[model samples]
Structures are given as structure tokens and as C-alpha cells.
Target: LVSYKRHLEIMGERNSYSKTDLDATFMRMKEDAMNNGQTKPGYNVQIATENQFITNYGIYWRPTDWGTMIPFLDSFRERYGTQSNEVVADSGYGNEANYAYMESNGIEAYVKYNMFHAETKRRYANNGFLVQNMYYNASEDYYVCPMGQHMERCGKQHSVSDLGYRSEVDVYRAVNCKGCPLRGMCYSSVIDRRSIKVNHRSDSFKKHARELLTSERGMMLRSSRPIEPEAVFGDIKFNHGFRRFRLKSNRKVRIEFGLVALAHNLRKYSAILSKRMMGRNHAYATI
Candidate 1:
């Protein structure tokens, strides 16, 4: 039908769209309505903050934060005319692609991986069977199985992202997994030879990221990151009551949010100026 053709045109690259707003994607709302899995038409907003000021912002149709990282950073670079020296973000922004992007740009990434918090727990004896805990020999390019079996480098698996970025992962397969004692502790009922797909590039990136994220300066930045965006969001939504978008389409909505951010910055500046007039040395506690 004509409607199908029009919808195909509107949903060019996206999987879903709202008829009311063609550019709006149906994303899961942040608020969990009692796990009802409610979805609404909206755009994912990305913002960078420094000392509680919204420095740069972007509007994304991508629902997940990980996929939006590169585009958001690119937007920031486009606006600032240079890449950031240091980037601090939560686990949601930590991934192979993001880490690679930062490393190639010489940016210190103080980003936590998906396993960062879980790795803090005491790793048990059985946990040694996990791929991450397994010993990797860089020179040999292989992994050691829990039962002392040598998992040699066999082949590679190629993965292409939604953005069409291709990355290769080296797959290591155990030389022998038949009749191994630790087989039950490792995998399931069907006992094929044990194998693990490892992205060497990503692992290296993650190792560097872990080092940077655990340093003293990294700790301070990580602690301060929450204060930057969370407070601004609270100020705008809770205090200013500027949650709902006033516009319909994407471009208009972006402009509308820009005004909201400007209002927030001006209000914050007014508060700081007032505090300075009162002879306060530090206003709003600069980071």
C-alpha cells in the first residue's frame, strides 16, 4: 500500500518508528512501570558536563548508550574542534568500539567495563573455568583450560556492528575436551571440545582501561562524574519541571532542549554570582 511505502521511507535505517512522529523511535522508558515493558516515542539524549555545566549535547535515535558513544563524541569534537583528552563514563559506555576509538585518539578512558563490578568479588575455584579467568599466553596466542589442557589458537570470528565497523576475535579451542574431569564445571550436558572466542584487541583495550580507571586521578574523576550530569538532570527535571518536550519533530525538539540547557546554565550562573557577591571563595564547589 501507499502507507507501507511511506513508512519505509520514514524508517529508512531504524527498526521502529512512531506514526505520530516519524522521526521518533519507540524506546523503552527509563522508568520501569512495574516491569510492564512499556515503550514510548522519544529520542535518546546525550550530554557532556563539566563542573555541572552542560558543555555539549546530542540527540540520538539509537536506544542503547553504547552505540551512541562514538556519534556523541564525534559531535562533541565537531563542536569543540578537538577531541577530549580524558573521558569519564559509566559501564554503559564501555565497550570494544568505544575503547578502541579513545585509544586511537590518545584519550584516557576512565570507563568501567560490564564486568568491572563483578570482578571485585572473590573469584572462587570453579570460577577459574570462565574464559576471563583462564590464563592467556600472549606469545603463544592461546588459552589454558582449567584441566591443564592447552586451548590453541584455531581461528577467528568476525563481528560487524550496526554501524558497519568490523572487528576480529580470535577463537581458541581446547586440544582435547573428551573425558576431561572439569568438563561438568565448565560447560553443559553436550560435551563438545571447549572453546572461547576472545577479542585480543578488545582485551588489550580493556586492560589499559582498567589501569586508567583504577588510578588515583581516575578515582577522583569517577567520583565527580555523577555530580556533573546527575545533578544537572535533577535540576532540570525535578527542580525546573522541564521533563516533557514541547516540540514534535527531532530538529525542533533539539532546539527546544538547547533552550532548556541554556536556562539551566543561566540559573546556575546566577546562583554562583549571588554566592560570589556574598564573599564565598568557592561557588558551587568547582571540580
Candidate 2:
């Protein structure tokens, strides 16, 4: 029998793998063909598509989309010789590092974060009680709480991520709330004071991205972004029955996907040509 225990040590954070395909890492399968929420040995395939055509693709061992964006973009740059002017992605690709990278590379980001949707609800409206609802005076650098309390900057905090990215956050505290009537409603603190932390730079980046995402051009791109890659995924998975990889290693799997992508593009091209030909024939018959 194979040493399963030794394999587990080698695969930290990746719980399982196939004996035959050691390159495939265990990830939570979306379809879960067995309906048991079982982890399957698979590669997280990342693909970039434009105008419903696959522009670039990369097979990643990592399961999550968080840290995989940089490498995916790097692959795109390597293939195209330059980065795109704009990138439209869902909340999965929105983070500090990704935003910073895109900004530095002069790419307009139309991405959403985890709380973007939540903050749009009626409950999150400008009710004054919530920190998001509070109004800040940029000139004075102080926030006016719902109860008209001045929350001034108290201190600064520095946070470092696992990837060694450091972020500076400004801490703000309410001047005094010892006998405020809205204390319980505003916050649940026995000390009767409230504090809020803001990463100003990150917030600015998110604000810029949000503005771009809400613009007319951005909305058009956002609508088309889904149709581009999502349609390709549907065609590959449901239509072509490519739910699992037959190959064992990452390089081999990439080659397999390359063939699949090539076939898909050719099929699409043929369909377009056929439609044009039929249109011309119909015109000739009408004449």
C-alpha cells in the first residue's frame, strides 16, 4: 500500500490527492457528482476571455482565487506582451494586493469586494448609526456620528498579510459617549465609546474601482464580462463533458485544455461563417 500519511505531510492545506495523479490537488467540487461534498483531486483552471474567445488560460494548484490573480495576470502579460487597459472581475478577484498591482500597472479595475453587495441594501443606507453611514469632513479629518459626535483620529495601526503586504490603517474614536442615548443602538460597548479603523489608501482604491464599475462604459463591460468566460465554461463543462481532467500533471492538463480551447474557438468560427453564408443565400433567393 502507498504511504498516505507521508503524502498528507507533503500536501499541507491540500487535504487529498489521487494516487495516480499526484499533481492534482484536492478542492471542493461545485457539481459534487456524488452529492457528498467530497473533495476531488483537481486543478483550479483560470481563463481570460474577450469577445467570447479564450485569450489566455492557466492551470493553478491553488484552489482559491485570492492569490491566484497575480500569477494569472502575469501569464496574460507573458502571452500578450502587455497588460490590458481595463479588467472587469467579480468580488473573488478584489483585494488590497490585486487592486494595488492593477493600479501600479495602469489598469482600470472594475471589481467588487465581499461587502459591496451587502452595503447596497436598505439597512445599510445613510442611517447615521452605522460607520458606513457616518459623514466625514475631509478638511477636518473627523467624522460626525449619527448623534453628531466628533470621532477624531486617535492612532495609527499597521497590519501585514501572509504575503508580506503591509497596510497602514488610521484608528478613529468618538470623543466622548458616556451618557449618549444612542450608545446601545450605535455600538455594543460597556465602556460607552466607539472606535473605527480605516485603511484610507485601500478605501480610495475601492472607491475608484466602484466609480468605474458604476459608469456607463463600466456597466457595459460588466454585463459582457459574464457572457465571455461564463459561456466558455458552460460549453466546456456541460456541453463538452469536461468535468474532470484525464491527465495527471499540470503541464499535461494545460496541454489538454489548450486542445479543448482550440477546438472550441474553431467551432465558434465555423458557426459564424455558416450563419453569414446562410444570410447571403437567403438574400440571393429573395432577389
Candidate 3:
């Protein structure tokens, strides 16, 4: 009983784990064969692919992609002796920590944050009430609200994550919204003033990431990102029937996935070679 309690302590916020396969964490599977959302014991598989070929793969106990990205990239660097020049991932992997890590490693982050989609919509884009839509003066370090109110920097704040990552934010507050025409639309504070907290570093990183994601080269990369890794996952899950790991524990599961990845690469290579040979035969026949 004491040992089971200790195991729970180690698991932390994770709700369920298989008693037999301790490494297999309980995660919501994406519509099983029955088309039902069922929580099942599984490992989060992270894969890096380029030109539709698997470059690196890692098995993580955590389900979310946010925390898995840094370690996955680290493993990729260790395996290849160099990190990728740029990374393109979906919003699930996008956060302040990942953005900061990519920046520190000198990799261009074309990742989207949680609010990226909402910000693209016409309502959110045109809404002057949102902090993002407000214009800020860089030199003076103050935001100009839609109602021509200056939100001055009031104080600084420090936030720490569960992983012990510390971020510094600047707090800004409008002088007054009393008797203002756009008071309710701009803010709903009882004090008649609007305040906002801005993580300047994170905001800067996201701005750069957003710019890269919208550029021609970035757009091309973004379009191809899903095809590269998703196709491999589709082949593994649907074609090869690898819905769940046959092994137990993190180490054994990693070994199982390593074999699967090897098979996938070999199959891709064979297909490419066969296509090239067929092309050669066709050319010879034409002559």
C-alpha cells in the first residue's frame, strides 16, 4: 500500500497508469475503431521528419505536445550532432517555454500559440478591446487603448511554472475609464480602469514566430509539416495496426517504437528505389 502511494506521488497530476505497464500513461485516444473517445494506456510518440522521411523518434509518458517538444528536439540534436535550423509545429507544442528554448538554441520557431487561431478571426482582429489589438509605443513602453487612453506601466511581475521556468512580465493599467463612452466594451472592472499583464519576452518571441509562419518560405514549410509526420503516423496506426504498444515500461516501449521506425524508413526507401528502377526501365524501352 505504501509503495502504491509512492507510485502515485511520482505520477503527480496524472490520473491513471496501468499497474502492469507502469510507463503507459492514460491518455484520451483520438476516436478508436469504435469511434468513441476512450481513455487508454498509451505513450506519446514524438517524431521528427524531413521530406516525408522519419529523422528521429522518441516515446514520452506525457500526453501533451507542449512539454514533449524540448526533450524531443534535444534527443534529435544528440542523435544528429546538430539541431534543426527551424521548427514548425502546431499550437499544441507552442508556449512560452518552448518558444524561449528554441530562441536560446538559435532555432527559428514557426510554432503557433493557443490564441493564434482566435487572433486570425475578423471579430478578434477588429476588436479593439483585446490587448493584442491595442497599439503599444516601444520607445515609451505604453499601450494606446482604442479609446485614446494611455495604459502606463505600473509594475513588474514574475511568474514561475511547474517546471521552475521563471518569466518576467510588465503590468500596465489605464489611468481612468470613468465616464468613458467605450467603458463596458473596453473593460469590465469595477474600479473603472483596465489593466493588462504583458510578458514582453514571450510577446516578442511570438511576434517573430508569427512573422516567420506567414512568410513565403515559412508558409511552404508549414504546409509540408503535417504531411511529413502525420503520414508516418497514419501509416503506423492505420496501415500497420500499431494503435497501442505491445510492450510495457518506457524503456521497452521505446525499443518497440525504434523497431517500428526502422521498418517505416526501410519501407519508404524500398518504394523510392523501386520507383527509380521502373523509371530507368521505361527510359531504356523508349530508346
**Better structure of 2 and 3 per lDDT:** 3
Tens-place lDDT digits, model 3, residues 140-202: 999999989899999999989766689999999999889999887876779978899998888
Tens digit per residue, CA lDDT, model 1, 58-127:
8888888999889888888898899889999999999999998888888899999998878767864248
Residue 270 accuracy (lDDT) in model 3:
97
Greater-lDDT candidate between 1 and 3: 3
Arrange candidates by TM-score, descending: 3, 1, 2
lDDT for each residue of candidate 2 in 35-102, tens digit (9 for 90 to 100):
77767788998888887788899998887887788888999999989999988889998889999999
Clashing pairs in 3: none
Arranged by lDDT, best first: 3, 1, 2
Q: Best lDDT goes to which candidate?
A: 3
Q: Model 2 Cα displacement at 262 (Å)?
A: 1.4
lDDT assessment of candidate 3 = 0.88
lDDT of each: 0.86, 0.85, 0.88
Best of the candidates, TM-score: 3
Candidate number with the higher TM-score (2 or 3): 3
* True-structure RMSD, every candidate: 3.7, 2.7, 1.7
